[model samples]
Structure formats: structure tokens, C-alpha cells
Target: MAFWIFLPITLSAVSLIGCWTVYGLALRFNHICSLRNWEYSNSCLTNKTVTGGCCTEYNIPTISGSGTQFPENSLFSATINAASFLFVIFSIFHYAHILKKCTVHRFFSKSAMVFGCLAGVGAFVAGNCNPGELMFLHYLGSALSFVCICFYTVLLTFLTSTCILTGLERFLYPVRIVFSIVQVTLTILYCIFFTQKDFYYRHISAIFEWTLSMNLELFELSYAVEFYFFSSSMLSVLLSNRDEENTMILS
Candidate 1:
């Protein structure tokens, strides 16, 4: 009973930590990349002086005085790449553990693991691109991840529907199906509309305007939602079974 209760919490913690680790790695990568073309000299532009100053075009500014030295895009990519790699490993291990237990929804669990692996790899590769080039990679990677999310959502819906129909429970069936449909529709719309070149430029414009960060928060949100849904479904099944056993014993 305790194991069932703890499993979701543990998985959630691991996933969140993994995400943070990826974010840190991205910051480091950005710092390293920014240092390559940075200048370190008195000629550094402080506030766009209009004076006819004696300045060299390729002047090396001091590390401390260089303007906007932080490579936000690179850092974001690095974090995603690192985090995705760790996520892949974690998902694989989790899948194996679940399989060993012979869970009722093994099919859904296995499918989620496989799709999670693909999403992780895609994210890592997409994270390797620079700012201007990141759009293409990000779009492609995000599309793949969203597709996996849709699959997982559908699988969970099916599992939940089956469990309910089998007289396992009654209340969760309609709710699961409705959530699953909504997720599937939203994922499809995201893939179709958001992955376009025009949409990428629109986001770039927002980034330039400082309204949005280099990292696509939407991707993170999608992952979080899917994770929650799947994790909840798994927990529901475990809890329902436990309750059944208790009822049997009581009778």
C-alpha cells in the first residue's frame, strides 16, 4: 500500500529534478558558447556612444564589460539536451520496474516508455541548434514529443475505460475519456499549427520583444500535463485494486 502511494511521488520528484538539471546544463553551455566571440577591451560599447571614438571593429572587450554576454538560447538548448538524456534513462528504468510487477496496464506503460524515449532523443537533438536555427529543430522535436503525448493519453484513456467497463470502478470512466479526447485534440492542433515556419517567426518576434524566453514553455507544459495524467491513471488503478482487496477481506 505504501509502495503504491510512494511510487508516483518518487517519479514526479525524479522528473522535476531531471528537468532542473537540464536547465543548469543549458546555462553552462550558453556561458561557454558566449565566451567564444566575446571581446575584452576598453572599446566595448557601453550605451552606444555617438562620439567619433577610436575603436577597433573587432575589438576584444573585457569579459566583465562585454554587453549582453549571456547566450540565453544556447543555454536553453543545453539544458533541454542534458535533461532529455537523463529523462530517457529514467523512463527506461521505470518502464522495466513496472513491467516486472506485471501491472494491469502493462501495454500502456510500455508504450509510454517507448514514446518517452523518442521524445527525449528529439529534445536533445533539437537543443543542439543555435538561436536562429533552433526554430526548425524545436518545432520538429516538439511535434514528436506531442505525438508521443497523444499516444500516451489515448492509451491511458483506453486503460481507464477498460478498467471501468470491467466493473473495476464506475466514476472514473467518463472523466478519463473526456480528458483523453481533449488532450488528443489539443495535441493535434499544436502539431498542425505551431510547427509551421510562420509560427516560429512569430515566436522569435516575441523573444526579440522580450515577451517570451528562448525556451518554449509550451513543450514543458505539455510534458507536465501528460506526465500528470498518466501518473494519475496508474495511481488510480493501484488504489482501486487495493480498495477491492480490502472490501473482499472485510466481507
Candidate 2:
């Protein structure tokens, strides 16, 4: 049904808007330094104080850093968790679509499904494990999510180019290929910059992170075209295990 297309659309829109809203709130509440003057000036980042009266110096605002404070932190967590849930659904639907549209490339489809699900799990962990409180766990989750997502996109793009899931493969193939390349490139750059100590490098890393996320959202949005031809029955068949059903009935 055409209405099913809204799933990917909503996932992309909510993720983009929710993360930006959290960033805006972070700026408003002085949770992180502004991008306009993204610098540590006289060891004072903002006039406002959440804990003590003291103002703390900070680097350029990354999404995680921006959501480390009150109010905004709550929103950030909610947004990430919501996106994560949608991601899992999207993965399942894509898998079902592949199953319905093509009988070949079963290995690629299965690998993509596994990686996509792992990415969702990592997103969930990253959302719940606050970077400020649980730095190690949060970083671990973020790393897993990024790496898995990169793999997922590559495999999905390959499948799109090879499979006839959508008659629009001629268009989606090239587009997804470009998105996959950019995603991998930016992921690498973000990791490199993330390890730097200089302010400029750190700030550039934040920019890369933001760009990486937006690219991913756009990539997901492109799947709305596929969803336009989707049916809920596809997912049902994908989930139902005939052997398990037979075993249960016999028992």
C-alpha cells in the first residue's frame, strides 16, 4: 500500500528534526558552545549554569555532547531510541521486500538484515547510555552502530544494483552507490577527526558527524520509493517459520 511509504518518510523526518531540535535546545540552554563562536573563550562557554554557578569550557558541539545536559538530554535519548526502533522495522521490511521481489542473492540479503539489526541495537545502546555518565559504553555503542550501518548500506546498495526489487533500479542503484561511498568516507573522516586534540580538528569532526547522520537519513528516505510497493503480508511471511509452526502444532 502507498500508505506504507510513510514508515521510511517518518523515520527520516523524525530523526533529522528531533536531533536538530535537541541541538537547538542545547544551544539555548547553554549545554554546549555555539557553532558560530565554537571556541573556549576565557574558560567560559556559557553564562548559564546547570549545576554550580561555574561555567565550564567546552569544544564544538557534537550531537552526543549537545545532549549531555538536562531537558535536551531527554529529547536526544528519545529521538535516538525512536530512530533505532524505526531502523529495525525498516530493516525487516527491506528484507521482506527482497524476499518477495527476488529469489537470488540470499546471502547478501541475510547479511544486510543481520548488519541492519545490529546497527539498530547499537543505536539503542548509544541512546540509553549517556556519554557523560557512561562514556565507554556510549562510545562502544556508537562505534558499533556506525560500522554496522556502513556495512548495511554497502550491502543494500549492492542488492539494489543486482536485484529487481523496484523497476526504478536504474535510478536507485547509482544514487545508493553514491550515498554508500559518502557514508563510508565521512565515517572514516569522523573517526580520524574524533581522535584529534586541536580545536579545529575537533570542530571539523563534529561537522563530519552531523553530515554523516544527515546523509544516513537521506539514504533511508530514498527507500520510501520501495515502500510504496510494499505490503504487510511480505513481512508476515518473512517472520513466519514453517518448521517452527509444524513443531508447535505437533507438540
Candidate 3:
């Protein structure tokens, strides 16, 4: 049971480290343009940069942009798939934990699970559909993931504030609220800047995207505390067919 805490820990670690690794690899391969050179001309997009230079519009270094290359794309897809799978398990575990410990906030718990699972599915889709080729699907998946995660965190924060299921709720509630707010703020900024044609705004949006991802990873990391209290029995309860509507109704 104590080892369950590693689920969230690994999820956060894999997502954060793996994505940046892909970005670094993409840079090494010149698959994507640099993020630091603010003065880099848009001519880079027209093959005007030096020979063999990154001559693409992917100057943003977005997680999607960073993974548009060959080997890096493979790593990127694997990382997102792994992280998304863990997120689905995390959602299930959190819901089961709530059912095991609390009698109230069932609606919020169920809603959080829906959003969390949808977010995971979106991540999966985005991972498998590389943005360079499947731009529509990739952006669709990214949008779904972002939007669902925003709702998921807000609902989870609400549950944390109302229920003391986990002993860490007192601290976690405020912290989750802060994360939720920042996540929403960054999501909005990322969306706004993402639409601009100017490379500067696009680059800023990329920064927002990376920050949003790191913030989410940190949020997931906080749940390691809650997972520390998890038990295998909680999952058994969730899987049991016998339902007591009078007590806990998962449906």
C-alpha cells in the first residue's frame, strides 16, 4: 500500500522529465527551432537559415512541436501514453479513495473522474497523432486534455476543501486551489497567444504551455501524499458488484 504513492510520483516524474528530454533531443537533431533566439528571423521557416538549419515554423518548442521529428516523436508518444495511462489509474484510485473514506461529495467525485479520464484519453490521442502530420487531431486532443484537466482540478480542489478524507486535505485544499487558478490562467494565456502569427507571441504561448504542463505535474505530485494513505482494499471496494445505494453510489 505504501508503494502506491509511487504511482503519482512516477507519473509526475515521467511526464516532466520525458517531455523535456524529447525537447532536448529535438533541439540536438535540429528538428525544431531554438526557443532562446528571440531575434531569429521568420526566414528560418523559408529555408533561409544556414544549410541543414531548422527551417520550420516550429520555433515554439511546444511539447507537440518538439515531438514532430522521427526518433523524438517515438519517445514523445511513449511518454505521453505512459503518463496518460498512469493518469487514468490515478483518477480511478482517487475516486476509489473517496468512496472508501467519504459519504458526501459523490457528485464532485464522479465528475472529476469523468474529466480526468477524458483528459487521459485526450493525451493518448494527442500522443499517438503527431502534430506534424495529424495537426487537426493533435490539436483536438490537446484542447480536450487541457479543458478537461481544468475542470478536473477545479472539481478535485472543491472536493478537497469540503472533505477531509485525506489527512492532508487541510494543506492540500489551498494548494490545489492555487494550482487550479494558475492552471486556468495559464490555459487562457496559452490559448490567446497560440493564435497569434507573430513568433514572439507563439513563443510566449509555448512557454505558457510548458508552464501549464509543469504546474499540472506538480499538482499530480501533491497527490503522492494522498496516495500514501491508499490501500488495495479501496480498489476491491470499487470493483465489488454489490452496491449499497444507501451508503456509496459510484454510478
Candidate 4:
């Protein structure tokens, strides 16, 4: 029970911590930029010269790329990769434990875990490869990770809908269905927008990518509630069957 609960907690904590770490780095260096702005502007300009205190480039809703721009770029990459690796391990454990509890979707469950791990590895490869340096390996990793993550979410959504285990139908089924659909939709949009040479499309692509990434992280966090109850639920199911068998034998 304790170990089972730890998986979601770790996933949530690691993801939030990594995200905030990047955010903090951006804030610390005053690189805040709007995610949806047509032009990628940062606080580097805002902090430069404020004669009348009207910096036209000062935008709020920080774009994900600003965190990876300059000064703190390496730190952002390293932090994100480390967190990605840890989350990957936790994701595998999570899926494996679910498989143990509900053997209903054995193949799908296992496949989700496998692809989750692959996505994690691809994330690591992409983050560490720095697009400015090893663009090829980085792009390759990005493609692998995105595609695998899409499949992983779809499989995970199916698992939730199965409702094989007790006490989780309300938690997993309908909510995950919506999230999965949104994730895949955003993925398709990202694919379409990411390669556009136009600067406007590029920014839109970045926005979609950021939304997709954050959505996935929040999805992991949502499992906290599921994990909290699932451990006991699994134990109950196991013990109940055993006790039933014992009573029948005694009869």
C-alpha cells in the first residue's frame, strides 16, 4: 500500500518541482515572455532600459522557450531531463502495479508502460541534446517522445475506462477520456504548426507544445487521488478472494 501510493506522489512532486524550477530560473533571470505572442519577447528587454517605464516587450504568460533561451538554458535542460528520468521510472512502476491489481487489460496496460518508458527516454535524449548543438538527435528524440506519449495516453485512457478494479470507475473513466482526446488533439495541432517557417506559426506551435507538456504533468498529478485509494482497494480484493476460498474449503 505504501509503495503503491508513493508512485503517484513521486510523479506529481517531481513534475511540479521540475516545472517550477524552470519557471524560477526564468523569473530569476527576468526572462518572462508570453506563450501566445506573435513575437518571442523576454524580460531581457524589459530590464534593459525603462526611461518612462513602458517596456512594450513585457509580457506575462511565460512561453516555454524563454526558459531555454540563454543564461539558464543548460540548467533548464539538466533539471528537466533529471526529472523526466525519475518520472519515467515512476510511470513504469505505476503501470506495472496497476497490471498486478487489474489483469483485465494486461496487454494494453503493459504496452502503455513500455511506451511511457520509451517516451521518457526520448525526452531525456531530446533535453540533453540541446537543439542548438545536436539538432538531429534532439529532433529525433522529440518525435519519438511525442508519438509514444500520444499512444501512452490513449492506452491509459482505455485502462481507466475498463473500470475493472473497484472504486475507480468514477475517478478514471470519463475524466481521462476527455483529457486523452484533448491531448491527442493538441498533439496533432503541434505537429502541423511546429514545422511552419512563419514566425507566427512557430509561436503558436510553442504554445501548443507547452500546453501539451503541462497537461501531461497535471495528468500525472491527478493520479494522486487514484493512488491513495487504489492500494487499499487492491489489497481488499486479494484478501477477499483468499478468505472466500478458505471458507469454502472449511465447509
lDDT of each: 0.45, 0.86, 0.86, 0.67
Q: Write the per-residue lDDT of candidate 2 for residues 91-200, one digit (tens) a residue.
A: 98899889888889988998999999999999889889998789999999999999999999999999998888669999999999999999999999999998987777
In model 1, the Cα lDDT at residue 91 comes to 57
The Cα RMSD in angstroms, rounded to one decimal, for candidate 4 relative to the true structure is 7.8
Candidate 2 segments whose C-alpha is farther than 4 A from its true place: 41-59, 240-251
Q: Which residue pairs in candidate 1 collide?
A: 22-79, 26-75, 26-79, 39-60, 39-61, 40-60, 40-61, 40-62, 41-61, 41-62
TM-score for each prediction?
A: 0.44, 0.90, 0.92, 0.74
The whole-model C-alpha lDDT of candidate 3 against the native structure comes to 0.86
Ranking by TM-score: 3, 2, 4, 1
Better of 3 and 4 by TM-score: 3
Write model 1 residue lDDT over 96-192, tens digit each, in one string: 4454334567667768678778867765655564333455665576557656656655664565454322243255556556656665665555445
| lDDT score, candidate 4 | 0.67
Candidate 2, clashing residue pairs?
none
Poorly placed runs, candidate 1 (over 4 Å): 1-70, 103-108, 134-136, 160-179, 195-251
Q: At residue 83, what lDDT does model 2 achieve? A: 93
Candidate 3 residue lDDT tens string, 204-224: 888899999999999999998
Candidate 3 colliding pairs:
none
